[model samples]
Target: MGSLLLLTRIGGRPAAFRAEDIGSIVELTEIAPVPRAPDFVAGLTGLRSRALTVIDSRKALALPGTPDPPDVRAPVVEVGGHAYALLVDRVDDVVAAEGEPTPPPATLGPAWARVACGMIETAAGPAVLIDVAALVAGPHRAAA
Candidate 1:
């Protein structure tokens, strides 16, 4: 079944995902920093009775860094086995796409293709669809 993915910004680019992938959406909050982990590791937080690793999406995508928010990006995540938080610029509401799926750019636009399903036109311009599993553990996503 098709689902709605809450939209967010990665590297200032528009992005989305299926609702199933999301555990929960919390406003920018504090994180307990991780030691010796990747710079992108924004740290961890508890959600739905589990700890999810918050990460800097821009850093993970190798984009230029932005100022650290006193209240950081919403940590929309997937947990259980694969756990990682995407630090987006901000988040919008979940959009349900209608009609056929639009294809992403032929070339894997950013190095984030594994996660990107492609761009689809909504009432609001074109939204990039993302595969949560791919985003977290695709061949493209670098190792920790």
Candidate 2:
């Protein structure tokens, strides 16, 4: 079966997440820092009175640091019964996934390969589909 996908810019590269995996898309706001949190954890923000942990997409993808543009947004996604705000560069559009996703390319590198579920073709080109669970848990989780 196929599903809708939300295209987004993560670390200046195009990526996607299953639309069903997301709860809401919100504008970038003040995020309270969490002392001693992992580097990839962008910190925390609140939406509708609920606290949300924000994951820095660029850091998670091992990309060079770039300032968050004015339009940056966080897509609230739930995994393992907890919610996380994925701090992406921008939220593009929602599109219907054409077919089943194929395995991510080996050249995607370690950081991306760890969280990428697969790749799918979109009108804008191919986008690596992100695995929300792996992203939220992050790479260090396995070592801990």
Candidate 3:
């Protein structure tokens, strides 16, 4: 059997995260902006009395920002002992992988290449398998 995946959309493109890497999915009602933080860092929000750093998946991929409604959907994850919420364009169903991940195409581009693990087939079709840790790290830190 292939890995289970949580499908999502980022920058208007299909993407997935290994299900084992995610803690939960949430709808953020409020985010307090973080000054002096990296551009990809959306800000901070609360979840279960715990603070979560919101990472804008678009900015993390070096894409331009879109006007977001007050509420945002995100997948929750923990990396290096810190919790983070990855803001995505949309959240889709959780599906089992149809096959193992294969190398991403050359045209995947630098921003994607930096965080993409590979491409995987799912019932929903093909999606770029994203590295949760890499996404939370942001483009600058992941590149370094």
Candidate 4:
């Protein structure tokens, strides 16, 4: 079943993470840091017994790195068989795709844009339909 995505602001920019990817929205807790990982990797948190990685989705998108505003929250999403919190300013309403998924844009630059399957129009405008799995856990990261 094709469901809607909940919009949110990632570092002042608008973005959306599919509701389906989200296991649940949770309150912030103790997020411990891990060593020798990507800067985009926010850290890890314990959910019951499982350790979930928290990613600054904004940072991951190659946006300017800004210290996460404390007020911002995250959705624990199951990505690459592991959990990661996509930090967003706020979670907005869920809405359906207005029409068929659009193919990748020819003029779209930037490396990550390739991972975006396409765009889907919504009430506000078009939201990038990200291929989460590919977006995450992709080719091994070169050294930092």
Best prediction by lDDT: 3
Q: TM-scores of all models? A: 0.76, 0.90, 0.92, 0.77
**Stretches > 4 Å off in candidate 1:** 67-75, 79-83, 107-110, 138-144
Ranking according to lDDT, highest score first: 3, 2, 1, 4
Clashing pairs in 2: none
Q: For candidate 2, what's the RMSD?
A: 2.1
lDDT tens digits by residue: candidate 2, 32-141 = 89999988898888888888888887777667876555356778998777778987878899988888899999999888898899999876788999998888876554
Candidate 1 yields a Cα-based lDDT of: 0.66
lDDT tens per residue, model 1, 11-37? 667777667787666754567888987
lDDT of each: 0.66, 0.83, 0.88, 0.66
Over 21-102, each residue of candidate 3 has an lDDT whose tens digit, in order, gives 9999988999999999998998999999999999988888888866354226789999999999988888888999998899
Clashing pairs in 4: none
Candidates ranked by TM-score: 3, 2, 4, 1
TM-score of 3: 0.92
How many clashing pairs does model 4 include? Answer: 0
Candidate 2: misplaced stretches above 4 Å? 67-70, 141-144
